[model samples]
Target: MAHTSPAAAPGAFVAASDVAALAAGAAVFGTGGGGAVHTSQVVAEQALQEHGPVPLVTVDDLGPDDLVMLMSGIGAPTVGIEMLSSRHQIDLLVREAQIAAGRPITTLMAAEIGGSNGVGPVGWAARLGLKLLDADGMGRAFPSAAMVSMNVAELPCDFAILSDVVGNVSVIKTIDLHWLERHARALTVASGSICLGAHYPMTAETARGAVVEGTVSAAIRVGHALLSAADPVQAVAAELNGAILLTGKITDLDRRTEDGFARGSVTIAGTGADRGRLQRLELQNENLVVLEDGEVLVSVPDNVTIIDAETGQAISTEMLRYGQRVAVLAWACDPIWRTPRGLELAGPAAFGYDLDYVPFKEINR
Candidate 1:
C-alpha cells in the first residue's frame, strides 16, 4: 500500500462520474485481492447518478465522542457480481448494527480499502445523510475480517449485521473477529455467495488511531493519474513508488473452490527481455505469491498486482484468463504492516504460507 501525510478533515464530495476513478484506484490498492469492482462500479455509478454527489469526511473530522461503523461486502467478488445484493442492504446493516448498540451512528467507514469495499459505502452515505470517513481498517484488502488493523488495535467487532440478496438478514453478536469471519463466510455461501455487512462500531478516537489515513484520497488521485497519463501502468508505479516486477502473457490459469473460498494459481510466460521464462502466481481470494523460476518475487502484505499490459486494467485473481498480456507490480505497504504484530496478523504466515514477511524493498532488490 502507498501512504501520504494524513488527509485533512473531510467535507469533500465525490462526483458521480469520478466514482469510477475511485474504484480504479481502489483496485490498485486491492493488491490482486478485495474482489473485483466491475459490477459494483456500474451499480455505484447508477446510484450516484440518481442521488447526486456523496460527501466524504476524514477521521480528523470526527470528535472523540463520535460513533463509527465499518462497512464491507462478504463473499467472493465473482459471486457478488452474479448475485447482486439489494442497495437497501447497506442501510439495513448500518441500522441493525446501530440498533444493537442502542445508539445512533455518526459516520460509516470501510473495514478495508479495496476495489468495492473501499468506496462502496459512498452510496449509503448519500442516501442516509451520514458522514463517510475516508480511512479504512486494512490499507489494502485482506482475505479475513480479523486481518483489519482495528483488530490489531484490539477493537471489539460485535453486533455484525449481514443481509443476503433475497432479504435474509442475520444479526450476529460475536466476541471474536475470527468467528465473525467464519460464520459470515458460511452465511455468505448460504446466501448464494454475497452478503453486505456492518460491524466493529468504534469511538472516533479508536478509529483515528486504527485506520490507514489518506487512503481514499490516494485512490482518487491514483485514478486521475491513470486517466491522464500516457502509460497508465508506469503512472501507477511512479505515483505509488512501485516496481514493475514482471511483464508477460498469461499461459494458463488454475482455479477452484477451497474451503468455501476461491483459491488458484496462474502461469505467465515472460515477454520482451524476460521471454522463455515463466512466472507463477498463487492465489487465495487474492494474489498470495509470485515466483519466477522457483524464486519468490513478491508475496502477501506487500502488494502483488497484475494489470493489463496494454489497457492497465487490473485482473483480479478470479478473473485471470489465459492468453491475456499483463504486467506484475509490487510496492511497500504502509509502515504499520512491517511491524511484528502487523506481520503476525497479516503477513505471509498469516496467509498460511511457510514464509516470513519480506519488505517490498528487500524482496524487489
Candidate 2:
C-alpha cells in the first residue's frame, strides 16, 4: 500500500494508521539495522494509545533558544529481541536528561531514522508532551552513536542520560564526544547489552547548523517507495540513487558476542549477473562494509544493507546465516561525511580499517 501522510500535523492527531505507516517506512530506512520494525511499531502503538499522539514540530518552528533533547536505544539488536524495555526506562532517561540539562526539554528529536531509534523518540515525546522534530541526525541507520554526522561536525555531546530496563539510570557529562560514546557503550554493556539514552540537547539554532535536514521525510519516502514498487530493492535504489553492490547466497558466517557488541562477517557466493564472484560483509551491530573479490565495494558512513533476494525484507546483521540468498545495497551517505574532517571522525579508518575512505559512487563506478 502506498503511504499517506496523516491529516493532522505530526503530533496533533496521529491515527494508528500513521504509526503503522511510519513504522513500515522506518524499516525500509533501517538499512539492515535498528532492530525489528514489528517490535518498534507495537511499542509505538501502545505508547500513542496510552499517552496520546506525539506533537510534531519543525526545526524552524522551535525557538532559537528552546532546548531540544535527542533520544534512542543503543545495544545489540539481538539482545533487543529478548530484553524489552519498560516505560520506566524511557521516563528515567528523560528525567535524568532534564536534570542534567538544568532546563525543561522543549522538544525531542530522533538520533536516527530507523525501526527502534525512530519510534523511540516519539514514545518519549508523547509521554513528555514535548514536540518531536520532523528530522533526525542520520538519514539512515548506523551502528554507533558516534557515527552520526552531528558528531562529525563537532556538535556537543556533553550532557546525556542513560537508563536500563532494570531501573538503573545515570546522567553522564563527558569532556569529549568520543568519551561520551565510550562511556555510554560501557554502561549499555553492563546493563545487559542494551539501554535507552537521551543526549545532545542543542538549541534550535545549533540544530539547524549541525543536524541533517529532511531525513524524516527521506525515510518516509524510502518506505513508501519500497512498499509501492513492483521491485522493492529497485525502488530503494532508485529513490536513494544507490548501487546494487552484490547478489549472492550466504556461504559462510562468523559471529560472536563480545564486549556487548554483536560483531561478525559473512561470505557470499555470487549468482546471476555476479556469478562466481565472492562478496564479504563485515558488521558490528550494523552492516559496515561490502567487499567484492577482496576489494572494498562499500564502507562505513555510507549505508550497507542486506535484504532477502526474493522478499526484499531487510536481514539484520545478527540474523545472517549460511545458505540464505541475499542482495547487498549501498546508499550514499550525507555529504558532510565525505569531508576530510568527517572521514577522520567516522570513516573506515576510525572503524579500524586501514583503507582510506571511499564513496560508494567512486567504488561502484
TM-score of 2: 0.91
Query: Residues 1-365, candidate 2, lDDT per residue (tens digit)?
Result: 10122222433444344676576566656766787777777877877888776666666677856898888888888888899998677777777887888889888888878667876777667777777777777766777777776776777776878889989987788888778888888999999999988889889777775776666556656667777779987887788788777788999999887877778888888899989899888887777788776788788778877878876667776677889998887788877777777678778888789886778888777
The candidate that wins on TM-score is: 1
User: 158-225, model 1: which lDDT tens digit per residue?
Assistant: 67888877778898877788888888888888887778888888786667677787787788888888
Q: How many backbone clashes does candidate 2 have?
A: 3
Model 1: lDDT equals 0.79
The prediction achieving the highest lDDT against the true structure is 1
**CA shift at 278, candidate 1, in angstroms?**
1.5
Over 4 Å off in model 1, which ranges? Answer: 1-5, 8-10
Cα lDDT for residue 212, candidate 2: 66
Error of 1 at 309 (Å): 0.2
